[model samples]
Target chain A: MSILLHDDTRVIVQGITGKIGSVQTKWMLQYGTKIVGGVTPGKGGQVVEGLPVFNYVEDAVKETGANASVFFVPAAFVLDAFFETIDAGIDFIVIVPEHIPVHDVMKMRDYADEKGITALGPTTPGILVPGKGKMGIMPASLFAPGRVGIISRSGTLSYEFAGILSEKQIGQSTVVGMGADPVVLCNLPKILAMFENDPDTDAVIIVGEVGGEQEEKAAEFIAGHMKKPVAAYIAGRFSPQGKKMGHAGAIVRGSAGTYEGKTGALREAGVTVLESPIHVHAWAEKYRLR
Target chain B: MRLHEYEGMDIFEKFGIPVPERGVAGTVDETLNIAEKTGYPAILKSQVLVGGRGLAGGIRPVQTPEECRTTAEALLETEIKGLPVREIMVCKKAVIERELYLGITIDGYSGRPVVVVSTEGGVHIEETARTSPDKIASFKIDPKFGFYPYQAVALLRRAGLDGKPLNACADILVRLYKVFRQYEAMIAEINPLAVLADGGLMAVDAVLEIDDSAMFRVKKMLSLSPEGRIGNRLERKGKEIGVTYVDLDGDIGLISSGAGLGMASMDIIGHGMEPANFLETGGGITADLLYKCMDLILMKPLRAVFINIYGGINPIHEGAKGIVRYIKDHGVTLPIVAKALGNHQEETWEILKSGGIHVVTEAATEKAVERLAALLNTSSPMSRS
Candidate 1:
């Protein structure tokens, strides 16, 4: 079974009337996701893609028993929308939009932690579960059904990694975007823990990059607790120091967040480290994971 | 965005954190007036965001009006670490009994605010963390309740501090933490938080960097600079165009839909050509944004252009039209290569190829880079790094 999402993971789209929200809602539905309904304050009694919309999150949850949410609210209102989801007891949340102020995210993380709710991203690429359903804006066609569980810090790299594997006929069970922001709610170690408990996943792939010590922590956790084989590919290998390359979080500050450090840590933890994302099939072949 | 030294002091004074007597000036006449008000032996420091100001001839101690004029004029006109100085700060120099370092910043790993204190002040914090790790002490703040009273004391006590000196520094740390939280700053630092001869502590130098993402709400809380944060002109233009662009010392102009792909486009080892800049369109792309993106990338020195994009949430076909429009408008003849896929894939390829842009429809980014290397007529061993 999938870790956070499964056959019964009912999700409600927040800000369903917006351009991005409506477009992604259509895509998610087409991808076989179990999107129950939607929420918007003013346009309560509307329908988007045949899904009923309600005024508030609680109303939507009351009507459809929606336990998960994916938001495409504008940057300014994300704080209120996120708090509403947390208050409505949404078990899972995936925030898709970028440029939400970091302080608002910090407060969201704190409240979500207090309630023990799982929130994926403020700038995440969203999560995809092949052959079951999907949430967020990941191109569902690029993935295949397999036994590999993948987690990544960058959305585009994860797509490349999964696309390469799909080309090689190696499918994935669940591919999670860890959110590209510097301060994400879920760290590598925590998502690894979730992947470990997922019965559908046989092996886990840690797709990381230069910028922060999340990889080091994941390496430590993998060496100590994980039983399934782990493979990793850290991006930004030749990225210059102190310059923000991709994500706000993907920077090498001083001596802490470097490509060498992340790769070294994972290798030290007995993880099969690939030189690049295109070499993902090599890891799958070496482990006979396909 | 990193705040200038005078701006940091303005924030510090508002928080009741003691700072040196000073005022910011934009011209030599204003500089002389402020320096005269501070009497002899004044400090003239350039107001810049970049580091290494101390050794860049941007900071000097002047004792006479003539010295102040010359130093202030030179600093106002000069660039520190390639960042132009627009203002100068004149402060009444202090007699320091000792120097200490104290700062609060969000730690990368913990995703929590951290407080760091060191006895070694007047030195770059990075150098201190690298060369003398033992001399510095840091602790993460509890996300729920924030810094406890004893944590600040613990930080200073590790630096052989005791009694009055310890209490004073700890008090400053608490105020600094408050300012850090209130402003939503990424970095709030007081280098050489000087313990003066009169048994008082003042922030001799200050650094406060607010997270640019928070400016939407934070602009209401604090009075920001009227012009806002000063940045590289092209970087500022990139922000206005709703993309992230980083100018680099390379020969190839590169653009991608995501940060990961942009860096990958540059890191291909066998290509042997360096990327001139890094630009990420970040999922949301409009024809206008794409048209403007071409204009921005062309501002840099480049031998060729390489683009890697995957459209998940982006309307990439519309973006292709913008690229074609830009090519026609500017009459650009540089060899350009693109690997764009997902969503309306065939339409995107048609538009790009019609513009005489070499297009690779493969999922692998290496294929695009290899195509670029061949187009550049380079036969060096080509492979992904």
Candidate 2:
């Protein structure tokens, strides 16, 4: 009942021969992600970590029924990799490469929207639906099957919150890394809506960095659609104002994407904002304990 | 990848847009030669990547060869936004009877590319927009049909341009689109498109930002990268130290993942610390990468080093190993601290413990800063042997 990845989602790794691809593939496999096959241009017939490698995504998808792809391709080739995956009918694509030119991101965003393929990020940590399939580079050990749905812009922060939830015997339905890119089309509110509708989910924890209208958008969504208790923590409180953050979309342009601004918005929308990352678990606990 | 005016003109010429005859000159002699060759009463513009050069006095009108030399010398000596002027652009000065602005760019806010035109041009467009919002006319360029010829024609006509100038403006608009499409430009601009006394149109100032993804097609564009534009002493030291640092106007110094982390780190800095420069070491932290990161942070004379890593499966241990290796290979002398969690945590800790680098690990951001503050308070900061 979780979002993005699930048990039956067979995944393919593009650029599987590259260092990052090879390393993450091993981890994904170790975590029991159904690594059906991989795609490497010239190294088609080679086998990597027991999984077969294909020359193209189409061949890999056809042969393995892999509907998802994790792109470990470099920035220069990311646009082509995205197009190739889309052309090959891959439904979901997680792009981990960061530092792509802004213009390239604009085109990639346009293309992804046009195709309706759930494009996660150019610098995202990927998605994880607990006790099921894992994609991107999220630490699988932090996640346990639970009812708390978590979504964040930072990868490690998600792990920290998830670990906190896990320690308290509270598992997660899903955790999404929305990336640092400005596009917040699939943000916390959207995920919250899905989690709220899911019978297995009881509460939601939104971990947001200061930047963009994403938190505001999520707050609006939560205000309207979300009936379940939502606990939230927005990072970058100590961050300097009017500074650009790590993500392309995370910059605090004027008042937008600021931690204070986001927290204010979330609070106005009836979200119980945590004072610190550690407080997220405490708030969730109080809601459960009550 | 924002292109300098010279690069923008090159694309403009290719698309048949009428820009003032211009050539980039690195020396006063070259400036004089270009001014003479292009004919006198020319404009010598400092070739820098940043804007506000006009206010900074980087743009000058040279009526004589002596004036060209003085202007070029003045420009080369001056620094605009931390970039020293190395080259000055010598361009033929047209009799600008009227100044109009024209630009085609992606409106990131709207999630679509748009064509912006204005009758008021010579001044900063942003300032003008805030002052006289009604003077600017903007039209969204649909990706399906792009900037239509009729839209361009109508836009110019509405902007108080008519007759030959309107036709010329339309032609330039069409050409600008070609340049934008050909080079995969994110922003193609011709500020103050002058209506000469003779009723002809000429672009006086241009700026183009090429899409980095399309670098494969424009391979030669790498040679014209802003790296050689205006390098500072700090940047040079950073380069020497093997870190990638950009001097920023903030108290907190950031060194993080190449683009995403770098950007996120900056936002985090702004959100958490103070206005700071973002130093992205791109990915794959080598001893060299860490050195570059540290050097960039030091170059800005940052008070603290905020090393935040969300290196998923990228292995924090490898990153920590790089940092430890950097310390062992080249001892650092600065107030540094970072937070790393995930992937190679155990192995990363092993490297830190075995290396004995005196690294601090805390879940609290305050503790991380406290450790950095404590290091800064030391009488003699640890010196690299």
Candidate 3:
């Protein structure tokens, strides 16, 4: 019932031989994710955590029919790693690497769009479908089985939002950290559309910050098509202007990227706007509380 | 990520786009020599990584070597639109029989790179778009096929460019598109593709912006000057803050991840709260840099400072070390509250173990909002002093 990921989705680790990759593989496997295979070019035929390692994504895909990739590649090798997944016809990719060059991001986006693949992040926390399968470094203890579907631009913010929802006994069907850098266009509106269409998700919690018109655009889309109750909190609402705080793309250019503009857009679209993060649960309940 | 006109034209020439014989001159003598070599009737343009140079008196036409000499001398030491004029470009000026504008840039609203063509040349295209939208023909290039020669030719023909000019414009357009993709440029523009009386195309003015993230690959892209494109008061404040500050026509100033948080902060301001500038301090936020950030925020005429952190590995303490050090060195002169989470909670707490600073502990971002709202009400003693 969740979007993009399910319990049956077989996962392959791209940098399985690395320290972080090995650790995360064990965590993901412990969470019941189907760790089908691993890839570490020169370390092919090696085994980590009892999982077989292959030299290439194609080899892994061919042997295990693994179509999803969780990449723990470093920034320098991220582009090549992504192409490997793309070449193997893997439709789903979650890139854990940060600080990838923006040009490579553009190339990745273009390539992904051309292939109609669903790729998340150059700085993402990966994707998670609660109680089913998980990829990324999100705290596992914070999640529970619930009807809320969450999407955010920050990994820490996602963790915070999940903890808030969990405190109210509100579990998430899926929590996707859409990354902040080389941010591919898995935007809020698109995620909202997916959440609205998903039978398991009853409500959607969207976390956004300043920079660009993505939030404003999401507000427009929410106004027109989002049938499910939507709650939003745009952080950095009180931030100063012209100083780059975080994320390369999180900039307010001209009249386009501002907190007021985004909030107004969301409010105009009938979205339950929570001015701060503390009010998310209350706002959600106000819209659909029992 | 934005390149000046000379830099863009360099890529244009590399890609075989027919650009005028030009050289960037950092001195008045060099400018005169370049103009002398290019013959009389040369153009001397100030090199700044921004638009609207003509309006800023950065672009000038020189009919004689004396004019070139004087203009270069005057401009080389001057500053335009906050960007210092380090060099002036001297190029062979074409006898423009006809003027046209052609460029390819990313249409952020559409999430695609677009080819923009206009019948009017050498003027601000924004004015043209406002006065007569139909005069400018735009096409959203499919990133897959991109801008092929035929597609570009068809687009130019639609814009009313005909005969050899149309074909030449098409060839230039294709090359420009290739340059855009090859350099991973955010923008590539030629203000006036002059139709020389001799039946040739000359790119009179050019500009390009390479994605900053791609700077690692573009080895030659050097930091030309410390003060660049300080567009406004806020930008000046950002300079005071000593961070990379790009002012938007908005009210909210953001502090987020280097790229993502910076962008998200702006969208929040633009879409949710008030409008503001976009600022990022992600990869290299040291203790000194934090002071600069604080100083920048405090100096600006802003309602509040929004601080958002998704600490990768630095932990809360490292961030706190920066903020606390900034506060101790410069003083908490402004109403600032931040939410920093992940990685090193204990270390972050250790750094923030101060009575003066307040850290929002709740996972719900609402805690941050309430704290900011409260801080906004209490006036800092520094404002009075």
DockQ of 1: 0.42
Which has the better DockQ: candidate 1, or candidate 3? 1
lDDT of 1 by residue, A112-156 (tens): 778898989878888999878888888876799999999988888
lDDT for each residue of candidate 2 in A127-215, tens digit (9 for 90 to 100)? 88787778888878778887777777766577767776676677888888877654422445556676788777788788777655678
Proportion of native contacts kept per candidate: 0.39, 0.14, 0.21
lDDT of 2 at A123: 72
Q: List the global CA lDDT of all models.
A: 0.82, 0.70, 0.71
DockQ of 3: 0.28
Tens digits of per-residue lDDT for model 1 on B3-106? 77887898888888899789889899999999889877999988777666786778899989999998888887787766787888899878899888887777
Task: State each candidate's clash count.
Answer: 0, 35, 81
**Per-model DockQ against the true two-chain complex:** 0.42, 0.26, 0.28
Model 1, C-alpha of B367: deviation from truth (Å) = 1.3
lDDT of 3 by residue, B275-340 (tens): 355666644456667656756655556666667665542233555677778767765545555666
